[model samples]
Target: MKITPELVEHVALLSRLELTEEQKAQFSRELSKIFEYVEQLGEVDVSGVEPTAHPLPQKNKFRPDEVVPGLANETALANAPETEDVYFKVPQVL
Candidate 1:
């Protein structure tokens, strides 16, 4: 899992990135360190460990859904300059 300059170059090409030689060298070192840390993590024992999707616990709050009185049609359409039967009318586009 060692990240070399060639691997970094290939990955940069795949991601459509224009990286300089210095950037490629820096990324190679950083990515290699990350891979080494991940390899170390693979050595940890977790035979009876439970897999979790989230690190923290979560719960959903619930409330009753009910219909409430809303604005009248006349009051709703009062601000509009154009109104057909009981709805606002706008210019039609072809």
Candidate 2:
């Protein structure tokens, strides 16, 4: 699929983006190249390849989770510019 200015403009409108004329042209070219690459990928033969949800084996991929003591409240609040009652104090929001 060839990317055109009208297509780019339509996408921009849908995405609520304001693109300059040059940017629109650039995006059109870039999008066209991506589509061409996808077309090339479509030409490859993968008839004998097995379908997989992931490339690596799923079992034993991560280390076992261990319970660790968290930092004390006083240590966690040591570097606060503004704190009140063990909590960070920020400006009031309306």
Candidate 3:
């Protein structure tokens, strides 16, 4: 598609951008080139190729989930500068 000044202005407004005349001209030129490249790509043949999510094969490598013992409340609060009955005392946020 041709990248016209009107199109550029619409895009800028949608993106919440304020572009100068020079910047709009520059962006229009750059965007035109990108669209031309995409148009050129449309001419390439890929009849036999299968669409893929990734270019290379990938698999999740995860370790087995294991149960572990957790620290007791007293042990966890041992190093706190301020503590309540069994919990750390922190300032109210709101």
Candidate 4:
């Protein structure tokens, strides 16, 4: 889990970043700490816990769909700035 300056430079290159030597060294130290912490977390006991996609209960919040009468063509086109018969009129597209 060591984060060397070379590793930092490689990641910087992948991320399209231009880091100075000082920044690379700084990031190397910081990333090492982060990886070390993650490694430590991996040692904690979670054998009794069940795997879950989310920690909280989830439910679909939508109302049931019901057969409903659709708007009439005249009602739909009533507010349009421009219309041709029952259809909306717009500027011609190429």
Which residue pairs of candidate 2 clash? Answer: none
How does model 1 score by TM-score? Answer: 0.46
Q: What's the lDDT for residue 32 in model 1?
A: 96
Clashes of 2: 0
lDDT leader: 4
| C-alpha TM-score for every candidate | 0.46, 0.44, 0.46, 0.46
Q: Candidate 2 residues 13-37, lDDT tens each?
A: 9999999999999999999999888
User: Which sections of candidate 4 miss by over 4 Å?
Assistant: 44-94
> What is the C-alpha lDDT profile of model 3 across 1-94, one tens digit per residue?
7798889999999999999999999999999988887898788899998989898999999997998889989999999999999989999969
Better of 2 and 4 by lDDT: 4
In Å, residue 27's CA in model 2 sits off its true spot by 0.5
Off by over 4 Å in 1: 13-16, 59-94
Q: After superposition, how far is residue 34 of candidate 1 from its true place, in Å?
A: 3.0
Per-residue lDDT of model 4, residues 1-94, tens digit only: 9999999999999999999999999999999999988898788799998889988999979977998899999999999999998899999878
- Scored against the true structure, residue 36 in model 4 reaches a CA lDDT of 89
lDDT of 3: 0.92
